[model samples]
Target: MAAAFLPPSLITVIWGFIGIVCPLFAKGPNKGIIQCCLMLTAACCWLFWLCCYMTQMNPLIGPNLSRHSILIIAKEWGNEITNTTTT
Candidate 1:
C-alpha cells in the first residue's frame, strides 16, 4: 500500500542525503575518513531501522495453545463440544 511504502521512502531519502550529500562538505586531510564514516553510519542505521520497522509490521512470534489450556478454557467458559454421527 501507499502508506507502507511512503515512510520507508521518506527515511531512505533522508539517509541518502546524509550519506551522499553530507560527505561533500568534509574538509582537511581526514575528509575521506569522515565521508566513509558518515556513509557507513547512515547505511547501518538505515538497515537496523528498516529491520525493526518490518518486524513490527509483521511479527515473528505468536501465541501457542496446548490441549490442557484448551480444555481449561472450554470448561471455564462453559463451551461444549458436540459429536456428530453420520449413517
Candidate 2:
C-alpha cells in the first residue's frame, strides 16, 4: 500500500538538495569540511523532523482523564456523560 503525503516528500527533497547538492558547490580551502558538515547536519535535522512527525501521527499515549474532569469537560461541551468508572 502506498501512502501519498506531500509534506514528508517535500521536506525530504529539500533536505536532499541541501545535503547532496549544496556540498558540490563549496569553495575555498575548507571545502571538504564544509561539505561534510552540511551533509551531516542535513541528515540529522531531517531525521529529527521525521521522527517528530511520525510520533505525532501515532502517539504512544492517550490522555488520562479523571472522572471528575471528564464530567466537567462533557458538561462544557454539551456532551452527556454516560458512565464514570474509577481505576
Candidate 3:
C-alpha cells in the first residue's frame, strides 16, 4: 500500500506508468480488455473530480452533510485524483 502522506499526484503517476507497462506486456484480448478498463477508470476518476469541485464550490447542493461526511468526501476526492492510469 502507498503511504497516505504521499501526494495523491505522485500515486497517480505511478499508477499511470503501471497501466502503460501492463498493456505492453499483455497480448490480444487481454490487452484490449485492460486498455478498456483503464479508460473506464480514468473516466470515473474525472467524474469524481468534477463532483468534488462542484460540491466544494456549492455546499448547498447537499447541506445535510455532517463534518465527518465532509471529511470522507475530501478523502475520496484525493483517491479519485490518484486513480488515473494510462493504458
Candidate 4:
C-alpha cells in the first residue's frame, strides 16, 4: 500500500545516473543546483514516506520497533553524511 507513495523508478534511475556523472564533471553552479535539488527532493520523499509509515503502522510494535522508520530516517541522514564526506 505504502509503495504507491514511493518515487518512480525512472526518477530514481535518472537521479542515480546524474549522481554518478556529476562528480566526473567539473564543479559548477549547475552541478551545485542539481545536487541541492536532488537532496531536497530526497528529503521530501523521506518525510512523505515517514508520514505514510506512521499512518499505516499506527500503534507501532515489534522488536526493533520503528525499523521501517529507521530505514527512512537513515536515508535522510545518509544524504547529509554523503554530502559532507564527499565534499
C-alpha RMSD by candidate, in order: 7.0, 4.8, 17.5, 19.3
Residue range 1-87, candidate 4, lDDT tens digits = 657545445555655555555445636768777776666666576567567766775666645647567666778877432324334
Two-way lDDT contest, 2 vs 3, winner: 2
Q: Give the per-residue lDDT of model 2 (tens digit) for 5-55.
A: 888999999999999999999999999999999999999999999999999
Worst lDDT 10-window in candidate 2? 1-10
- TM-scores for the candidates: 0.69, 0.69, 0.39, 0.36
Which of 3 and 4 is the better model by lDDT?
3
Best by lDDT: 2
Report how far off residue 32 is in candidate 2 (Å): 0.7
Per-candidate clashes, comma-separated: 0, 0, 0, 0
Q: Scored by CA lDDT, what does every candidate get?
A: 0.90, 0.93, 0.62, 0.59
Off by over 4 Å in 1: 63-87
Error of 4 at 59 (Å): 7.4
